[model samples]
Target: MRLRHKPWADQYMKDNNHILIQEPFEQKGCWKQLFDQQERPLHLEVGTGKGQFIAGMGEQHSEVNFVGIERVKSVIVGALKKVKAKETTNTRLAYVDAEDLRDLFVENEIDHIYLNFSDPWPKNRHEKRRLTYPTFLEQYQHILKDEGEITLKTDNLTFFEYSLVSFSKFGMTLQEVNLDLHETGDETNVPTEYEEKFSQKGQPIYRCRASFSK
Candidate 1:
């Protein structure tokens, strides 16, 4: 669902040049250097809505560089506000299109990718649009390390099953498969807006981490 645009979003994106990256393609293959050349592991969150999960992770893991990518300018503005209000140093927000993701980073430049509550693209015809689809996975592979991890969390059953099969078909080894992440009390989670709301209504949350060997 597309979010309603906030009036101040455009202005906020302009004024917050420190946190919002406008031309991410220019930093392809050199994102680490842009983050002060620290060489810390780069972790990316796709579709970072409201920025709660990445912002929290940024605070908890200061050693890791966190980049949250949201295509919608208005949507990413919320995350920008979260990063600013939290006074976090390790996290940055980027306005990026998922289809062009491969162009924004060179091969083996990303260490991890997080997909939280991503749009299911439920219809059979729209399967190609799913984040875990073979096409998207192929794109991610261009940027991720050999053993780089992709963590996913969602409350949708069909999407969960589809993702599990997709990962297996892509030659990825799945780990920490939890059909009920919230009930299982897996403490290492940073909840997204959708996860928190869905879990509160006795809904089951699914989570897993997949890694590619090749």
Candidate 2:
């Protein structure tokens, strides 16, 4: 499933000046600059859609390095365009699969991971494909620091409940589980493309933060 091979994705990639890093899993030390020369920790966003969330986070947290991983080339291009438009030097986008994150990042290298509105994989047969699956959790634990946190937000109730159970099974501590993100109408919560669409339909957004205990 090469995203660049799709017609729409090809145009989007060309329209945006996004340098596609194929097989990021193979380039283990390519992101050394994200941590080198700085004491600030590194943050990663899995399935960054259109880049709004990570770009906003980078703009607010200039001291931290943000890396956005998107499997879809079209989406990655849009995210890179946002980063470029904002002149955000603290952030970078990679066209990489979430399952390969462990291969790309070293152990205890990542400080935080943002899983915003990832694919729910609604079908029972596709449960393993869910971002919150135990297999993926293991990979996340391997890359994240002892105190690293994973912030998950989604509009799907089934996925949210499933993720809660999965986190508990993995011995991860869950915190700040919010069923409705807009209850307080906090301006700090930057909504992503999927979030915007789902929220417009009057759907309640579920959010929770989990941390690895080493």
Candidate 3:
């Protein structure tokens, strides 16, 4: 998508001086090398809006490799800018649809997956489009390692409730389900751009960490 008028478009275009790839799907293996170079577990964040959370995580946990996936080209470009500005070699951003995750990463490859403030798809007919839908969960199950965990954070209560039910139905174990993460006083839990904006309006953020069952 053209990002000419986006708020961060100009800054992104200027900051993306490091290696930025645009291949469709033929470079997954080469991307894997970038992760392997870190010699640590691989983590992925889907729907990285504005790139705050993943960028912070990448800076905080320099030992772990991070891969962020965004369907919107502009947003992906923005994320790449953050990685470049930080001069982070352990993080990579990919422009791909969430549904095509399995084609991008092999089974037992991913250590963790982050779904940060994903689209709720609130309408009944659009439920299937929700990132936490059963089909997408199954796709995550296929690509993630057997013990891989998914960390989900959202400001939509209905979506959070729906996600709990979906995880149960899929036999994934949910832990640390926080209905109000901000009140918990957990310094380690960094808030993303969307999370911060939504919470400032008195919206509660729902968070949970779930892992695939053996």
Best by lDDT: 1
Instruction: Give the local distance difference test score of model 3.
Output: 0.80
lDDT of 2 by residue, 62-113 (tens): 8888888887766677787787778766777778765567778888778899
Regions of model 3 farther than 4 Å from truth:
1-19
TM-score: which is higher, 2 or 3?
A: 3
User: What's the TM-score of each model vs. the native?
Assistant: 0.96, 0.86, 0.89
Model 2 spans with C-alpha error above 4 angstroms: 1-23, 26-30, 34-37
Q: State which candidate, 1 or 2, has the greater lDDT.
A: 1
* The candidate that achieves the highest TM-score relative to the unseen native structure: 1
Ranking by TM-score: 1, 3, 2
Please write out the lDDT profile of model 3 over residues 1-214, one tens digit for every residue.
4565577654565455343545536655445666547568889888876788888898888888888878776677767767777877777776677457877877777889999988889999999989889889988998788878999999999999999999999999997699999988888887898889999999988899999888
Overlapping backbone residue pairs in candidate 1 total 0
